[model samples]
Target: MSELASGVQVVRGEMQPWSDQATPHPALAALLTDVVPANRRTLILGPHAPQQIESVLAHSADVTILVRSVADAQQLGEDFGPCLQVIAGALDGLQGEPYDVIIATDGLDRVLGYDSSDLSWTERLGALAGLAAPDAVVVLALENEFSLLNLLDSRPADERHGDDEWRPLHDDPTRPVSVDQLKAALPWRAEVYADFGSRTFVRADVAAAARPGELPTRLATAALESVDVPLLSPAAEGVDSACRAGLLGSIPTGWVAIAGAGATRDVYTQTGEAVLTADQNLTGWDVTITGDATPAFDPAVVPTTVPSGVSVETVLFRLAAAEDVPAFRKLAADLGEWATTSRVILRWDDVIFDGESFAYGVSPWVTEEPVDKEDLLAAAWSRFQDRLIGQHRRHPWPPWMLGDDLVSAWLGMSGIEPPEQLQATSPDTAPAAAVQVARGKELAAALGVLLETRTDTVDVRTALAEAEEAKQELFELKGHVYGLERTLGFRNKAMKTRENRIRELRGQLQRLTTAHERIRGSRTYAVSRVIFHAAQVRKPKTVARKVARRIRKR
Candidate 1:
């Protein structure tokens, strides 16, 4: 092993220079806060988020991080203070004393180097266990092969394959596949967590998961919203189905096992800037929201306990789908009344109705500024409109009415006047109203893009093919029309020629008839006619016959 100037140690020939492709989740950092002790010998394995590394550093003075990438090791050494010991090599090559805490939250798959032999999952876990002290607290994450995310992915197997799968040992017979199997395979007693996106987890096994509107269902739903990948179908409906069957834990995207007790909450979720946790109490559930950043919304405005009822968003969706316009309008009125009376920032999905009264759902956000009643109503309805249209959800409204027009109509239904634009109570807040409108439209368009699945793919391709066929037909028709026009032009010239010939013949006949009339009117023709008539009286038949023959000859 050679040491660099940055104090990063390198076990030459085993270093990986490629990025490990690990995503850092704040929920993981929060979990580390609960389990990782202060001032203890700690070892972090694989490529972890910088946030996670910082959390570890804050807890332990003697911290050693093992990464297969040399560049990452050097970077970590430079970014962190001299107190951190960075090792660049495969896990097998590292020579280290047993650590009090071993964190492999990124999982054991990425710790191997380019030169390292293929290691099975069980063998990797054993290696980690060997490096841990007898009473060491170990936090390890295991990716589930049967995750809902994987099931919902519409891409073909070949398309889904990534560089990380080059040496994946998914066929290892000794590897654990389920949470129970994972717990049984562990050398020490471990508390297993169902990790969804590494942002929401069922930290403890709770019986209330089967009940709708509970922590488990809520966590799964929240995870659906956090998915960054396109899915074949809405995973929310699948998750809901799983929740109904009490099989949510069975289909976790991954499992996070803590070999020692660190997390006490029943469910843990991280939203934008805050972490929301739920702990079961005797009456119902206790929910709390905490964050490091100054909150934009008042924490007091949020509920201290879990609210029990159906989500307002779910009800709205159902009502809209059923085409129950009156019911939807009534619900909108109820929501408007609640917002106006409470004057708290509300998310449609984060509010619950218990048949009579509305309660705040467990959410990481709270709106800080008090909004005008009309604006509040407009914002909620506008967002609901976007979600409905974006998700390709069915509604009672006409097809021609959409986007802002639909939002305006919903606002009017909610008893807001002059719904063409958001009526900001103050001139200073006018910009916020405009921003809200833009944001709603942007979100709708984004959702439409993100949620486009194989259904859309097939539909679009079919439509395009039909369109192309129609275009070709139109081209052929245009060609036929041009040919017909050319033929008509030739016929018109022939008809004009025939008309000119007829006109010329009629003019010649008119001149001949005028000459005959002039001859009959002349005096010489009259005297000749009188003499012919007197001769005809003596030789009547012969003269008349001869005269008629002469006239015919002339």
Candidate 2:
């Protein structure tokens, strides 16, 4: 290994300008801690999360990480001190002693760099296996191109490519497509996980998941919930359908293969400090909880028997999808009566029914406080209502009925009194009401995200018609503006005419006043004014004498 100035060694090949990094997952790290052996030569290939590297370091002192991006190598070198040997090169060029523990949990796609030759999946797998020792524990995660997540993704092929995928070998005919094929391709006995990077991991080919109400089915459903981008359809529905078809293992988000021992658990599902496990019995499964956790419903009410039969959620989904209003109504009524009488908070997906009665599934969530009968019933139906609308599932009810109204209709059909249209005034219902309000806000935000996935393209003719209508509107607007301008011009002309007429009238009045003043100031006009004054003062004779005297003076 030739050490470079940047503190990372260049094993072989040239370093490229790649900057993509994998996200850290705590659950995946924990699983690695269990599978990766201690005090052995380990090689971590590709860009793995720092948490994963840290987990491996906790078990083993000598660890080497290979990454194509020089920046990634520098960062890993800085983050993990001198103990970790960071190599900056392509996977094919790296020559080293065989590793007893080989981890490529981020998969083989990112192992190639910009200057590397395009290698097929089978070639990459062979190269990876060749790097491993005879008794090495190889932990590899392979992404399924035809996973439910990929199948339900609304993004087109052209839009799905990222910069890190310089040349994606997706159409490799020799690569293993399914878990069964992947297991067969492995050289050693391997345990493959279905949901590898998720919060839960399950054995890919667990036969119990084929049944609808089995523990693996619930685990798969919960694990497959969309935490990232919105899917074209509900992942829960896909899981249920796949389970019924005995193909749940065929389309996992990804497969994690642990070859050559060290895997102790078939399923590893944990939330906070709580961990859930299942042991298969003759009939079904016996679930055991390790840590202290509360059920979503009241924990005080525990079922004496194990949960069996299909989930209420699945039944409701089928009825709504089939538009079987009667069956749905009956189920709603049964659920409402049971919840109201029990006065327990319940989630539809966590409750199972074996035809005779309902039992709580192995959900360990808890409500903040106990709720009223109406609140309990409303919450359950409201959750169902959200999934129905959020997933765009078809139902017999009118599309117009939505939100609180649809929830109320379901409650009414359940033979229970619908909740009052008033805020929670009493202190007794305040805590539960607050919880419901917060849940509603969260559900609304989630629903908004789901609705944004709709990629309905505008029809060509429709787009043309809309454009034409907009053009016509623009033409009409321009004409209206022109008419207004004409009217304004006419008004301006009339105003100018009136102004000119007023100026002419002022000129004529000025001329007439000047002529009258000139006539009034004349001497003959003064003499006539004096005569008229004398005639008005005397009688007719006195007026004649005054007129004669005035005439003589003139």
Candidate 3:
């Protein structure tokens, strides 16, 4: 996260010079390139030398760089050589010469590392006041107290480092160094200038901006065009109203306090590139499409005629690391598939890494209706849900503004609308996601009821679906158990019928045996045997043979 503070690396600790801090801020570079006198005494206090410092060193003869870390000083000396004497020492130890120029844009928080410096920012300012040469300039960049960007800040204020020592603002709404405080603390008269987009500061001489409404647009355009980072302007109405009410210069990312010179030298710069002034005096133009914060897409390229005029615009986004490149590749693949098969005729082309940021372009493939706010959101929202969401292999991803949806993001950045932060559910049923989704519902519900507000229909639906899916699974298991119970009941009734049939058969057998036994034992059985004997006696030889056979048988 070692990104540009005043359009240059706010080189704090290690691990960054590898990241966004790879390049110096152009505005700060311009400032140093302009102000650094030839062969004049100068002292730069920092962790590592900024690029502009080296440029200034090339011109100066008596240059001394007092860096915090001994290792950093050695590294800087190795990196920048005999052009400047890199000293590994504390600010208190720096003596023997008064510097003509002292540029400590990165604050005291970085200057005094683990070593506890009892001096506060103002105290440090007073200490710095001791080293300033007559007619010398003291340029210090400090974070603004009333910056709207602070409200939208996603990252924590401090990391491995300590507090932002020279920051005029505090997150706990702690005391900020007032103009009077700075005035009282510094030896020279100080004029604080609003450094917007941190490229240049508004001169105290200018009093107020010629156009205040344009500050928001300027803020966005500055970040995108200058730093190549998408910076959304505040969407708060009160912020804009404040700007309209002569508070445009009041709110800033940071301020440059140029001492030793008063409001006469209020502003200083050799303008690198002027942002938000691309369409300065266009008289009148039709089909004007200004980027609002509610961006439907980002990393998109579009082309259209401004009625009689013609122009093309492109917005590029940088992926944080190499691992994220594949997700964009997958997005391109899905977009291509959607273009070839679906009703949408949008095509994504020219995907390339621009060294700094991932560069990709998108354009409509066919003749279509001119894109409007609603239609753009509608088309993009549909495509995003269908092709994005769970489609990317890297998802559930950190929320990103890609494709044509940057418009929604732009809207939010400009303080005009809100971004559609689509939080995709994780592939596995990680309880974390479920819990977060539940919390979101609870928040949304509470807001809806208590505040009579609405937010994130998509998130609410997603959460509800998650809960219902789990419930439906249980219902299905219950239905299966119910089916088994009905089967067992029928089998039990059949078993009882079988038992009754066995009992009836036993009773029939008993009755039949009783009848046969009674008949065999009856007296009529003796008379029937006598008649049978008389028939046998009718034949004389037969009767004698029968009697002899009976005797032999007996």
Candidate 4:
């Protein structure tokens, strides 16, 4: 035995919380349940062990953790017990027992300095390659280099890890590899699976079955962080199609490559998990799944919560039975066509049952609630739009681009023709009426341009250009006026300060005059004046001499 193996200490610390969550990472959980079989002896190669250890151990399969650190080996051993044997110091440290599956969630090139072994990345893979049975599949996770998210919001290179793998613009030796590199590194031909979070857990076949651009990719920004920016940006548009074109390299946040085995029946075991839902489409409500349970779910019955003004109601409804059940059941039975009859806006919540779960017929009379809700919503949206307009009115209006896009979109919709301009009357308008009001403005602007273009071909373009220029000038003028108004406010404040200062000076002058009068009225002032006049009279002879000098100078 090697000197390093002699001191095979145990890795300590609880490794249970990783898979304990009600929603485990869908990819990681799927990889264990689907790709890694229940009967095979598996080898987990890691520097720092994966959080999905419990998911792997859940199958009650024989498992071994390959590590170069005695501490890691010891801690993992202590947490997982003797069934999970840990090999210390090297990949080849284990005697020639063939592993049915060799899996690594950590990328192949990540540092593996456990117990300070001098193994290069390629060398470790070679040893890992040596241990696998000829038919044994090698599954490893790597960052997909050409993911669409890479073109979108990018994080700092050094900071990106597994989740933020679609960062780094430059080729990082330490980072996840391209599909070609991953394929080249393995001993046999590789089958690649586009993976979200770069975790090699979900079956590639499952990921592929999703619609193009439908593969899950997360934004670099958080929900709170993206308040000013919508979840859908220019980069986000038609991403489904782009991903579908190159499903292997373009769309997945990361990828899983299986060298020995392709996607087979065993690969789809992780059909439903909570984390799988994290990649759901950006929709107002959840689940657009079709099909009636007993027969076929009618597409017409699905409730599509459309905007207030639009006339479409596709919300899904289910009918509960003669018996009360705690969980929801599909109304695909006798009531499927009945619910679509539109007697009442039926929904899961709307389907009220008695305490005994007895079925009730659809309501005979419909309430005016939907219309009332529309009115309330319109009022609220008008208030919100007013607030936005007020804020932007002082600043430059959001790029004419928003207005331009709105004009095109509203005009394209059938049966919308507004006058030259729209005037909103919020007091009496229904809630749905607010959307129409906005549409009126956008359509009016569009029609104005369309009319101008058709009226005179020669100068219409020039006139329209001038009109756009004038509109931009008006925006600038508004901004300038707003600045001047702010300055006027300051001037008013300063004028108030000046008036107070003048009053203070007037009071000081009044006090000084009153003090002088008091001195002049006193006997001391009269006596001093008389004495001073007499002194001047005595100096008259000196005055005569002064008068003679004055005459001589003249």
Candidate 5:
């Protein structure tokens, strides 16, 4: 793959390979040698042979190498060493930048481990395409054998295996993905590179060829000429695989008309006349006509002539959805040339009978209401601020009043009496209210000098000072709470330590009680207790002899 950069317009080449091949594919070599212009940057991805990279690097010192790791770069040697850059992880890291050309050999299939779903492959390939500049090229080298073989292998056996006997086969390391599978996963145009062994390559220009109904006759001819195989260029038969496979429908042509009572029949007729006169190719075929009023319009009024060499089949019908005036207007707009060519007239009998005239040919006339400059100004002024005194008292006043004199005059007009304490309150509250009013008036004026100005700075400053004082009080309260939290932190730590010590003591006491109970139940403890009582009795021997003598006397 290759592309020419902006400034110097130099072409660059790129090649990707999975296996350690000494020689790149002949088709790839040819593309690199032929397509790449001189003095531009080139990039190569995957674990390609060092010699192959060296060959391209010798031709252009601006070559860059993207590998899986630092070790891979080191192994590639001096030719690729300086230009080598590790991709870090997945292809996601390479997004967000433009590349002149991207060449993915087997890397697209090999980079992501074997996944049953084709989502990762599709997404990565799309990202690769996005990374390229508009005119840049993307080349994918795929193996056809791997794909065909895999397809054959995936077929079910004659007899299904029992649950105990079921087993899955390991993917062969030599083959990562099939060409057909990768092509199916891509969004752009692709074709198999039959000349280059099992490799398949897709160019960006080829992929984006032409959109639906946008193909030029010349390009369409070229596309058809290029198709030499079935399923490769299905567009040769006026159907791409996407359409043949039922993924998309053929481009729609013909005409549909929508007209209603409120629709602009004159505009529609004029537009249709313009299209018929302008386009030459749309001559004789029956123009499908539909619509409640469309069929009623005389076809003789519709312009039949067209410019030379233009061919189009006309199908005119009124769509149910286009019954409303707005819907009809939108449909006409979307129809573009068709709406311009086919005259579909709509009539408003009620409006005509009433003799009502629209200001403009279209709906929503600008001159519907008479303009009153004085009322407009008055309305605008009222929204700004309501003056509380003089003629302008309670009158809408803008934020930035014109001037003090103007304010006085407005006050007179509004019948508002200036406050007696105006001078006294001027410092504390007047400026603030004046500023608020002034700001609104200033915005309303928007560069137009409207509304009266008033000076109340002194009163406003006093009010601001009072607000500042209150704010300071609140700040002090917050500081006090912060101090309380600090004190609590120290107390909390002390309590925690005391609680832990108490817990430890309780555990030790419980262990001691358990040990004492075990000792009490042991045979050794019982014997020791009996011996101690016997010793005490021996000590009482004297007392016992006395007791025996007393018994004999009895």
Candidate 6:
């Protein structure tokens, strides 16, 4: 077999030991062994033998154990040999990472030198729950008998162990608490299991049982039994008292029986005798009685007259009885008038009636009377009319309130202007029709405004049309200006080129004229020289030579 299987067998054997040996309660052993899987993180609280720690370690390899003292945890480690992580400090050490399972053995009730005045078991349990993951479970193994004893012991004791030492014991006997008190201290939805032989109680799902007074001892016991777990003996006297007080009954389907003043023997006998002497049905019902230990019924306690103004309490009370009681219907009318003049607050208790009795108090003959069909129908109509009128006055034209035919007549009677549609129907409809009439007028007013705005919008459209035409004309003019600017730029460039060409031609003509003048001057001078030389040479052979010679010499 595998090591885990072998370890589990060993642990199981240790739990149930030889028949003669004193073993831990079977339920408790099963709980500790079955709750966590092997190799899971577990936090064990309280004092236990090294063998107990070894047994848990044998089944699970990973375990973080906690104990009240360092010596105890050290001794456990010496035996378990490094397989244990022991925390030796306050329970506050349990605050960080959420553990898979938190096992609290006997240590839950043991608080060392700490003030428990502000620290209740419920609060501590909540603190433990906070350390668990959402799906994590916290197992608290409390001694069942010790629970009651601890409650009583938590009061006071005279013994002195040290300055911080406190005695967990009480002197008062009348204040003894039962398992119910412990159950009341748990949060809602927590499961409580009792190991009668070991005198131990296991609280699972601590988070579920956090609400005060929601879990009763009997319910807790029942829950345990549903899981096939056993519980210690119940408090018979307490159960009897609850039954006698009418707080307990057979399991009800979809509803529960509520205790009333009539359930008590004294109240039933005295009040029933007084009211039932006039009716025969009182003896037939045989209603339960209740005791009134107070002094004789005082007339001063009952109000002789109602106040003038309307009260919500009185209104609701009368409304509740309006169908069956004529006096209640009359009171309702009076209350409606008063409500118009005053403010009122309603208390639920004042309006709720006992299902069996029509009378105000408990009595056998106080059975509810059959409703007067005709009176109820009339009252319903009257009250509805009154309520409608009141609502109309309060809110004549709520934004969502539509004016119908009924509202039209009401507005007409109230001298309010009705819408055209409602005005046409006003003569034929009832006064209660005002609600619809007012709504119609409001709708008409809104529509009229919408229509007027629509008409004005047409005029605005005409002006917008003119403005759009002007904008188009402006855009056309801008396009023309842009075209002109481009043309002017091209024309300016052409003019610049023509001016450059004219300047170049004028320069060339000036150079040519200078060259021609020089050439002409040279040619004229050479020809004149040639003619003078020839004349001088030819004139030397004749008489003319003298003139020529003179000319040549000159």
**Winner by lDDT:** 1
Q: Rank the candidates by TM-score, best first.
A: 1, 2, 4, 3, 6, 5
Greater lDDT among 4 and 6 belongs to: 4
Shift of residue 72 alpha carbon in model 2, Å: 1.0
Count steric clashes of candidate 3.
29
For 499-552, candidate 4 gives per-residue lDDT tens digits of 999999999999999999999999999999988886778677887899999999
Better candidate number, 2 or 5, judged by TM-score: 2
For model 1, residues 79-165, the per-residue Cα lDDT tens digits are 886878888888878776799999999888778877777888888888898899999999999888888878877677667768754
Which of the two candidates, 1 or 3, achieves a greater TM-score against the reference? 1
Q: TM-score for each prediction?
A: 0.72, 0.69, 0.43, 0.45, 0.26, 0.28
For model 1, where is the 10-residue window of minimal lDDT? 451-460
Tens-digit lDDT string for candidate 2 (233-309): 56766777788898888777788899885645656665444455565556545665555544432333433245557
Q: What C-alpha root-mean-square deviation, in Å, does candidate 1 show against the real structure? A: 10.2
Off by over 4 Å in 2: 167-170, 196-199, 269-306, 321-330, 340-345, 413-415, 419-554
| Backbone steric clashes in candidate 2, count | 1
Residue-by-residue lDDT tens digits, candidate 5, 1-554: 21212111111211122223333433234334333434445555545555445445555556555543333334454343445433422344444457564555444543331222333444655756666666554555543332212222322443323432212232434332433344555544444332112121222222233232211211222223232222211232232322234321112111111111011111011111111111112322121212222322233442232112111100011221123434333432332212111122211100011112211011011111332322222222333222222112222335355454343433334333333444454456664334433533433343122111222222233355568989998999999999999999999999999999999999999999999999999999999998888677755778789899999999
lDDT of 6 by residue, 145-200 (tens): 33312222322334313333222323323221333443454443334433322321
Quantify all predictions' global Cα lDDT against the true fold.
0.74, 0.73, 0.45, 0.44, 0.35, 0.37
Q: Score candidate 4 by TM-score against the native.
A: 0.45
- Residue 522 shift from truth in candidate 4, angstroms: 39
